[model samples]
Target: MESNSSNPYKDCLVNEERRLIDERTNVGTVEKKKIAIHMAQSNSDNHTKELDLGTKTPKPIQPILSAYPCTGLGKDRRCFQPQWYKSFTWIEYSITRNAIFCFPCRNFPTQPQKGYLFVIGYQKFRKVKEFLTAHGETNGHATNVILWNHFKQSLIEGTIKEKFVALTKSEIMPPGNAHYCSPPLQNQMLSAAGNIILKYIASEIREAGYFDVMADDTRDVSSYEQFCICVRYVDKTNTPKEFFISFEKVVDLNAESLTKTLISTLNNNSINAICVAQAYDGASVMKGHLSGVQEKYRKNHKMAIYAHCYAHKLNLVLISACKYLPQSRKTNIGENRASWRNFCQNHHSSENNDHIRSYKIPIDTLNIYL
Candidate 1:
């Protein structure tokens, strides 16, 4: 009931004897050369789903006299022999077409020129070896070789997901000194490696039984509040170590929010159970007994002892001393103070005034003992 006028398989004669060698199956003879090659590659790839071992060196296929008919005469009436097939790895002889083809060029042809043997049959037997050698030395052939090697090496390294390629000869040997990876690509690779290292460090810290957590929040130049967390613990050798683990953004700087963020980070690293102590700056929200971060944390973990930073206490004391101390005023203290006051009141001379002016302290500095 099908009309022959619109038949898709009209020109493709499907031979039942040998299906693989039919003209429809040959990628080189088909109008859809690209599609045929893609389909053939996909089918082959589906079968051999294993790591590419870059060592797929070609072993010359042995051709028999009956199977590969070479009795056809060339331009010079010379008959092709089995010795010609043994000479090259890329050369593939066709018995039906009486032609020779380049295997590598046919499979992975590069740009500009895909080589004459890739498109047309090479039937001239007089100088066949010369043409083969010339085709092997082209830029396209070298590029294809590099591509094949890179694909195989990537599969073996288990970095097929990363899609990292091996450095080419031009990149390795150079005045260039740099590889082909862009800045963004390099950052991505480094980020992956950094994540792996962080996981390892986290695991090591979790193995230690007890540790102390130190946290502080600061506003950066961009006005973003970032809270930094550090852990101090002893290793298997009993060596004390402190490690800065994480920096988290603080959307809300209240006791509840900061406690939640810190607890979340600890839980993520699997170290929430082993915390023995907590340290933070002497902010009212952190040190307040009723509704402080320390108090909130103790609701979950009671054994964690809270400690205010001594350096922060010292800074507050210094600020108080500077604020209360008078710079230019002198109070009466001992006999020295009375003596100095008597001398100043009695001797109202210009020389005494010059002497007092020489020792007078500036308003900016605090003279605590004066």
Candidate 2:
């Protein structure tokens, strides 16, 4: 049984429902919000995105009244109604508890609710109409609504907020140059949409149970070393699928550093993937039997296999090629080899030998004549 003791919330309420839903669930708040909102259709990175379809929390999502359970004394039985949800926009239903609640009051009820009412839940559908209207008129509900509107305004208007009621009433976009169209708002929208997609993908991968990891590091034009992590798994149909999940900035190419960075990124995304295999080029830091990334990772997932793939190194070569292009040549990533001949020194020899030796060499980079 849940504790009858009520904990009053006194925080802002714009996007607060996400926190409430998560708190009601067992998972982390950020992760739960991502997966829940993931159901909303949003722009994909590969697509040529247009502004009109930008990410936005259009409205609050409540439960379907059709599924509401019924209860009451003889002949006066009642169930939640769709019209009530429509009339009281603040209405929310918890399928777990088999009851309806007020979205605002559930998190930040300012006044005491006798019999727990909407704060905990209000089940007497027979009296719901009378009680809901009266509750809405109370000072508690009005105060909570004020705070919610303020936070909502901050998100869309770059201020804490005070405008949900007004914004919902507006039909058209408030001109492109308006404060609502600011870059910070656009970036936040894009990030929110991206996190939603990432969390959804993470869920699918974890549900698949066993997976393989693929990773490689590269020096970006900004001189930052980034490790790109990918995962491959077979879905319920036994069909193989692969996804690029993250590109994390790392301190260096040390096996320990890479392992920590990779593990942290995976955990943050809530992807506790059971790695069955790991694929990477045969660099000592990646494939070394003593203490490489594969070995370190296997300490956590002992069953994982280390599979070397020559083609996996192609990703880094592509990054190297980008530096040679006319658009990028002007701003070069520093190199100290002096000349192409000196850069290729000691012999343009055997492929595997060069591969291992190149793995631990200086940071000046290779003889990329491309």
Candidate 3:
């Protein structure tokens, strides 16, 4: 539909098409369509973008406002004080709804309770302080608050206050009133927070009834062998999760010493009995069938089957495959179309290749993967 077309046939078709469309829907404007779509979507329980509490990624609007409208109500004239918004930063004021909503709970509700703060927003201006304070103190509220903080941490890799400053120096929170600015206090706070988070992860693992153990040893910058132990389990939602529980200096690298440390760590957490699997790199000290770390762990929990670390095997494979590469491919393949040439060579060389030729079955792939 080019404007002012010279061809009469084209002009006639365009005008006729426009007429039919206009007749079908008298108001075919984009604005009208948008309004209709919004009206249709408004009845559902789904939250619209406006009420998503700035949780959607790829940047979000600043939620904390400097001034919350004081909706004066009740006999003693109780209302939402604008100053309160400063103290309780998790609360968000809705202009359209004329209510305050819990920003954290709205996004990450810990329970299936139907609190107004989580969805429709809270408008009980009368006794607002009493209810708001009580809501803040709830375990669910605290959990969601922590979760919201964790979400913010994911969006920006920095301290909470630093995140605030980076986001816009938080409206309710002034820069001067910020506390725990000192390094020592920050370290202490971080340690306590880590312990709390670790406790929650450990509790979730134990609650899941069964879990797998993962341990690896690596040399730190100072050349000290650091033995790290972690656990992998499916959560209540059936989503797999791995949480690091311990990272300690390895005074001894012997299988017995490593077994003792690992066993003690699991016993302390009371998950040693329920351990269903243990994965470690193919090191003689760790995976040796005869009295190795795996054998020692299996002695206590026979159900805990041993597995060679997949990632470790992949690393070994990659290193071994590097030896098969041509010197031309191994050279500066990054520069001047070398990578492209190598990729083309590999692609053409693999043209007739089939999965049957590479691996007869899926179990074969798994066996090689292990």
Among all candidates shown, the one with the greatest lDDT? 3
Instruction: Work out the TM-score per prediction.
Output: 0.39, 0.39, 0.45
Residue 66, model 1: Cα distance from true site in angstroms: 91
List runs of model 2 lying over 4 Å from the truth: 1-181, 313-370
lDDT for every model? Answer: 0.60, 0.63, 0.67
lDDT of 1 by residue, 21-128 (tens): 333443344534444444344323322343221223342133456544332121234445667765776566544335566655655556643333554345445467
Query: What tens digits encode model 3's per-residue C-alpha lDDT throughout 1-370?
Result: 6586343433343343344334545454874455434323431222333564456433222345565454321222334566667677677766655567777777778788465676655644666788789989988989987877777776669666665565564655645768646898779867877778877887888788889999999999999999999999999899999989878788889999999889888777666338899999988988999978999888988899999997787565444434444443455534646644453335324432342244332323324643
Residue pairs in candidate 2 whose N, alpha carbon or C atoms collide under 3 angstroms: 149-162, 150-160, 150-161, 150-162, 154-159
What is candidate 1's local distance difference test score? 0.60
Per residue, candidate 2 scores C-alpha lDDT tens digits across 1-370 of: 8784523421122133334444554566576556445312111111122222112233444656446666532334577787777789977755544456666665555666433344335544666788789878988789977766765766777541224235546655455445544679868866877899888878888889888888989889999998999888888788898888888988877999999998898889887878889898868999999999999999998989898763544345435644544454554344533442343453245653455364543223333321
Error of 2 at 277 (Å): 0.8
In model 3, the runs with Cα more than 4 Å from the true position are 1-179, 270-273, 326-370
TM-score of candidate 1 on Cα atoms, chains taken together? 0.39
Question: Best candidate, TM-score-wise?
Answer: 3
In candidate 2, what residue range of length 10 has the lowest lDDT sum? 39-48
True lDDT of residue 57, candidate 1? 37
lDDT of model 2, residue 348: 46
